[model samples]
Target: MTEKYRERVCNGYDHVLTIDERLYDVRTDHQHLLIFKNRAFGRVLALDGVIQTTEADEFIYHEMMVHVPVLAHGSVRRVLILGGGDGATLREVLRHRTIQQAILVEIDPSVIDLCRQYLPNHSMGAFDDPRATIVLDDGLHFLQTTHERFDLILTDSTDPDGPAEMLFSRPYYAACKASLAPGGVLVTQNGVAFLQLDEVRSSARHFNALFRDWHFFTAAVPTYAGGIMAFGWASDNPELRQQEATTLQRRFSQTGMTTRYYTPEIHRNAFALPQYILDAIGKTSP
Candidate 1:
């Protein structure tokens, strides 16, 4: 009993000590955020009450969030991010080098402070990049107020609760739609396609109503249960898929890089809905 009490995680999520000495369970937001400390993967991340990620797993989340939609848009010069405090998203967005500017609007500044202090690898030099600007505010409010448009907008958010709820609303979708450049693309975490399937379908439908070329997709991360996760992409026009002339090369070559998941072709397959998702899309009430 003493051993169990000593080692057991206080949070509801199922995380065991990876290095025991390195990464330790700290606390939880109950059904939401599971706070942990690690020698890797950085700190202050929320896993959906299942598995937690290691340092290596964080790369998949960062890559998928920043890459797929941006590449689909053909060229992303100016970018906007909502709620990605871990800086993993910021790190990946900086890769193409063509990005003139990137704006990261995160509600809780503490999250960034934690990750920056503990998870330096996750963010690289994103916080110091001259082209990247970090704003501390509610993202939904930013969408409502910011008049300037972007080539890509990536929503890096928590589960559909707490501060992230409004980010999934139809009004928010409409606001984001209005706040984009003509050929801009938007991508968001739509929650798990397995458990939150209904919510995912509903959110996709609202996005579809707001944008012309829309797709729902998935990526796997070991920390995010079964290493499975979901995302939705939307754009103003179908031309995004046709590929426009861009200064940066659109195709991704894995010939040298170490990526556990996500590739150019994988981007296309991620949108292939499971049979249930196809049926539930229009039926789900927003």
Candidate 2:
């Protein structure tokens, strides 16, 4: 049997995919979850009618988000990941041998369990890694109480809504800043810059206030429509984002990690924002 599932991921558009079989459908405490098999996207996961990730292109988003900051810092020992219940982010973080510990704070444990059962390819045994510590708690509360310092913090959160809305707020960002080790870096998903310009501006305003250096970068994930999605970058040390191409290339080669979408050259180019994005982040020409 075949069926069609449609999702309104953003304003004025819909993402439709064919479901070869319905694997799991239930309403978790946080949101409705659906797991299905699709020919194009392979295994698919959705929450509250929004596509979370797909097996076909999950690597693109996960690799770019995890590698850019980790490789740039060049000394990331501990990482704090917010809302990455899918474990793709944790999978990428573990690839770096420099990382000593990775703590994943996910509010919903069911998302983790379900994703592990259905979309194991995305995580690929990352949860069982010895260095990983899974904390089933709210991201903000975990930051508020933990005295631990991290060399890198990555917020793999959903859009500004529901429980995740505060993850983009000033207070939560303040908590994140306080939790970072000196010269530590923080990054967040800022939505699609082409359609969600306000998100970019708001993140810039908040991050600018708390951080000595802040900027935006872009990555194209076809699953996330509306042009290229932006990631918010903040670090007390500005030079981290401006590492020379040769330096990045050497570090990437040292890792000996093969990737499908992220390259050292692409890492450098991701920061070369378009003029419109520059204007949106209030970086217009003087």
Worst 10 residues of 1 by lDDT: 1-10
- RMSD (Cα, Å) for all candidates, in order, is 5.2, 1.4
Q: What residue pairs clash in candidate 1, if any at all?
A: 41-55, 221-227
Writing each residue's lDDT as its tens digit, candidate 2 over 145-187 gives: 9999999999998888876889999999999999999999999
Relative to the true structure, candidate 1 has a C-alpha RMSD (angstroms) of 5.2
Residue 244 of model 2 has an lDDT of 95
lDDT of 1 by residue, 22-119 (tens): 33344433233345544544343544443323465777777888777777766679999998887888888887677899999987776677667666
- The window of 10 residues in a row where model 2 has the poorest summed lDDT is 277-286
TM-score of 2: 0.97
Superposed Cα deviation of residue 71, candidate 1 (Å): 1.4
TM-scores, each model vs. reference:
0.80, 0.97
lDDT of each: 0.70, 0.91
- Report the error of model 2 at residue 97, Å: 1.0
